[model samples]
Target: MPKSVWFLIIGMLVNTTGNSFLWPLNAIYMHDYLGKTLAMAGFVLMLNSAAGVLGNLLGGFLFDKIGGYKAIMLGIFLTVVSLIGLTQWHEWPHYVWLLTLLGFSGGIVFPSMFALAGTAWPEGGRKAFNAIYLAQNVGVAVGPALAGIVAEKGFDNVFEVNLWMYVLFFFIALLTFKRFETDSVVPKNVVSERKRITNKASLYALLIISSSSVLCWIAYSQWSATISSYTQDLGLSLKQYSLLWTINGLLIVAAQPLIAPLVKRWENNLKRQLVFGVVIIAISFGIVAFASDFKMFAAAMVVLTFGEMFYTPALPTIANQLAPKGRQGFYQGILNSATTVGRMIGPLFGGIMVDQFGMMALMSILVIIVVIAVIPCLVYDRPLVKRSKSTTVLE
Candidate 1:
C-alpha cells in the first residue's frame, strides 16, 4: 500500500472507532442514561444531522480556500472539543447540543478527507477508497463490539475511550500532515466545462441517487430502530442486538475488500455499481419484510451485507469522478449531505412505520424508495461511460 493509502486507512480507522461507540448506542444512551424520552433522543439526533449540513458546506469551502490539510485539522480540533464536552455532560439538552457539535465536526472532516485523498494520489483513488472503507469497517466493527462490552461497565467508559481516540487522531494528523500539500490550492483559473450531461440530467441523477442513498440509510438505520424491536419481539437482549451489529460490521470488513476488486473489474462504472447496490439492497429489504425467525433474519442480514459491499464504496468513488475540478470537496460534501439527509429521515420514517405498521411496512416503503432510485441511474449510462475514462487516477 502507498503512503496515502496508509494515511486514509489510519485516518478512517481512528475516525470510525469513534463513530462505532456513538452510532450503536447514541439514541439509547440519550434515552436510558440521560433520562430523555425516545422523542427527545430522536430530536437530538435530528439536530446533529441538521448541523452536519452546515459542516459539509464549511468543510468544502475551507478545503477550497485554506486547503484540505487545514480543513481536516480544524475538523479534528472541533471533534476533540465535542467529544470532551459529550463525555462531561449529564443534562439532556447539554448532551444533545454537544452531539450536534460532534456531527458537524465529523461532517467537516469526512468530506475533507475524501477531497484530500482524491488529490493525494492523483492515482489510485478508488483502491485507496476501498482501503479507507476497509479500515473504517474494521474500526466500526471493533468500536461497537467493544462498546457493547463497555456499556456493561458504563457508557462513560466508552465515551472516555472515544475522547482518547479523537485526541490521538488529532496529534497523528498533525504529525503526518507536515509533508502533505497546503501551499498550492486548486487554481480557480481552469476552464470549467460541464460534461455532456445536461444540468437536468445531473440534477435528476442527483435526486435519484440521493433518494436511494436515503433508502440505504433507512435499511441500515433499522438496526437502531425497528430491527431492535423485532429482535426483542423474538425475545433477544440488547447484547444480542449489539451482536447483530457486530455481525454486520464483520461481514462488511470481510466481504468488501474481497469483492471490491472484482466489482471494480466487472463494473468500472460508478453509476452502475451504485444501481447494482441499490437493487441488492432492495432485495435485502424484501427479505427482511418476510423474515420472522432468527435464521431468516440472519439470511436477510447476509443479503443486506452484499448490498452494502457494492453501494458504500461506489458512492464516494463516483462523487470524486463526477466532481468538477477544484470542487471535489464540494461534490463529496454533497454526497455526505445526502447521507445526512438519509440519517435525518430514515430513522423517523422507520420509527413511524415500525410503530404503526411493523417491520414489513417499513421494509416495503424502503423497497419503493430503492426502486425509485434505480431509474435515473439506468438512464445515465452515457455520462458514466464517459466518466469511466478517468479510471487511471483511481485504478
Candidate 2:
C-alpha cells in the first residue's frame, strides 16, 4: 500500500475509535442512566442512523466538489464541536441532539476517508477498501475495551475520552491528509448511464444481494442495541459486554490467517460462502437465546464474528462483480444504502421485539430471519445462469 493510503487508514482508525466509544454504549447509557425504554433508545439510534445516511451522501458530494482533504477536515471540525457539547451537557434531549450531530458529522468523515483511500491507491483495487475496513475493526477493538474501563469510572469520562480521540484524529488529518493528490470530479450524465443497464441478470442479482445485506446488518446491529442491554440485565459487567465487541473486532483482524485456506477454497463460490455464513449466524443466535453466562455470550460473539467474516465482505464483492463498467458507483451505492437502511431500522426493530415479545422471542425471530435470508444468496445468480445459457444457444 502507498503511504497516502496508510495515512487515510490511520485517519479512519482514529475516527472510528472516537465514534465507537459512544455507539456501543449508547443504548446502555440511555436505558440504564436516563431511564428511557429500550424502544426509545432504538428510536434515537434510528434517528442518528438516518442522519448518518444523509451525511453520507452529503460527504460524498463534498468530496467530489471540494476534494477529500477539505471534506474530511470539515467533518472532523463539526464532530469536534459535537463532542465538546456532549462532554459538557449529555442529559435527555441534549444528549439526543448531540448524538445525532455527532452521527451526521462522523458520517461526513467516512465516505471521504474511504473515497480518499481508493483515490490514493486506485491501483490497489479492493485492497484499499479492505485496508480501511481492517482499520475500522481495529478501532472497534480498541475503543470499546477502553470505554468499558473508563465507564467504570463514569460515562462522563467516556465522553471526554471520545473527544480526545477525535482531537487527536483532527491533528493527524491536519498534518498528513493534505498530501494526497486526489481528483475531485462531480458525477454527471446519470440519464445517459441509465441506458447501460443491458445486463439485467446482473442487476437482479445485485438487488437480491442488496436485500439480503439489509437483513444481515439488522441482525448484526443487535449487538450494540438490544444485546448490549440484555447483557446488563443478566448482571454482567460493562467490561464483559464491551469485551464481546473487543473479541469481535480482534478476531476480524487476527483470524484472517486462520481462515485463509477456507476462504481460498470458496473464492469463486461466493454464494456457497454466504449460505454457510447465514447458517453459522443463525446457529450463533440460537446459542445466544439460551446463553446465561458471559463465557457463553463470548463464544457466541466469536461464532458471530466468523459468520460475518463470510457474509459482510461477500455482499460487497458480489455487488462489485455484478456492476457494469459505467455503473460501479451506482451498484455499490445500492449495497451501501441497503446496509444503512438496515442499521437505521435494526435497533428500533430489536427493541420493539424485546419490549413486546421478550428476548427469547426476539432471538427466535432473528434466527429465523437469518435462515430465510439464505434463499437470496442461493438464487441470486439463477438469472445469470439462464442468460448465459440462452446466449450460448444463440452463438
Candidate 3:
C-alpha cells in the first residue's frame, strides 16, 4: 500500500469514530430523550439519510472535477461546522436541522474517500478496500465503547466527544492529503478506447449490483434503527445496546485475520462471495426474529458481523473495477447513493412495520427482501461474461 492509502485509512478511522458516537444513539436519543415516538425518530433519520443522498452525488461530482483533496476538505469543513452547532442546539427542531446538515456534510466525505482509495492503490486490489473497511471497524470498536461510557454521564458529553474527533480528523486531512492527486492508474487514452467497447456491459452490471446493494443496506440498517428500540422494549439498557455494537465492531476487527485466508480462496469469485454474504445476513435477521435476551441479540450481531465482513469490502472494489477511467467517481457515487437510498427508507420502513405489525413480521420481511436480492447478484455478471466471450470469438 502507498503512504497515501495509509493516511486515507487513518482518516477513515477518525471519521467513522466521530460518527459512531452519534449514529447508534440517534433513534434512542430522539425517542427516549427528546420525547418523540419511534415513528418520528424514524422520520428524522430518513431526512438525515436523504441529505446524505444529495451529498453523495454532489461529492462524487466534486471529486471528479476538483480532485479528492479539495472535495474531502470541503466536506470536513461543513461537517465540523454542523457538529459545532449540534453541540449547542441539540434540542427538538434545532437538533433535527443540525443532524440533517451533519449528514449531508458527512456524506460528501465518503464517496471522495472511496474514490481516492480506488485511485491511490489500484495495484493493491481488494486489500486496499479491506484496509479501509478494517479501519472503519476499528473506529466502530473504539467509538461505541467510549460513547456508552460518555452517555452514561450525559448525552451532551457524547456530542462533545464527537465534535473533538472531527476536529482531529480535519487536522489529519489538512496535514496528510494536501499533496494527494486523483490520477487514474490506467492512462486516459487507453481507458477512453476501452470504454467505447465496454460501457454498456459495465453500466448494466453496476445497476444490477447496485440494486442488490440497496436491499442489503435496508436489512442491515435495522440494527441501528428498529432493532435498537426493540431491545429496549425487551428490558435492555442503553449500555447493553451499545455493547451490541461494540461486540459487532470487535468481531469485525478481530475476525479479519482469521477470515482473510478463506476470503482469498474465493478472491476472484466476488459474485459468489456476495451471495454467500447476503444469505448469511438474511439468516442473521431470522435469528433476531426469535431473540428475547441480550445473549440472543449478541449472537445475531455476531452472525451479522460475519456477513458484513464478507460483503462490505467487495462492493466498493467491484464498483471500482467496473468503473471506466474518469467516471470512477461517478460510479462510486452511484454505489454510495444506492446505500443512502436504502438507509433513507429503512428506518421509516422498519419503524412502521414494527409499529403496525410486530417485530416478528419486520424481521421476517427483511429476510425475504434479502433473499430476493440474491437474484440480481447472481446475474449482474452475465452481461460482462457474455461480452467477453463474443470478443474472444471475434478475435
Which runs of model 1 end up more than 4 angstroms from their true locations? 34-39, 182-184, 190-208, 229-234, 256-262, 290-295, 380-395
In the range 210-283, model 2's lDDT, one tens digit per residue, is 77877877888889999999999999999999898899889999998887787778878888889988899989
Q: Is candidate 1 or candidate 2 better by lDDT?
A: 2
lDDT (CA) per prediction: 0.72, 0.83, 0.88
Q: Name the regions of candidate 3 deviating beyond 4 angstroms.
A: 184-194, 389-395
Per-residue lDDT, model 3, residue 365, is 97
Backbone clashes in candidate 1 total 0
What overall lDDT, based on C-alpha atoms, would model 1 receive against the true structure? Answer: 0.72
TM-score leader:
3
Candidate 2 is scored at a TM of 0.88
The digit string of per-residue lDDT tens for model 3 on 93-189 reads: 9999999998899889898899899888889889888888888988988888888889989999999999999999999999998766675333445
Clashes of each: 0, 0, 0
Return whichever of 1 and 3 wins on TM-score. Answer: 3
Which one wins on lDDT?
3
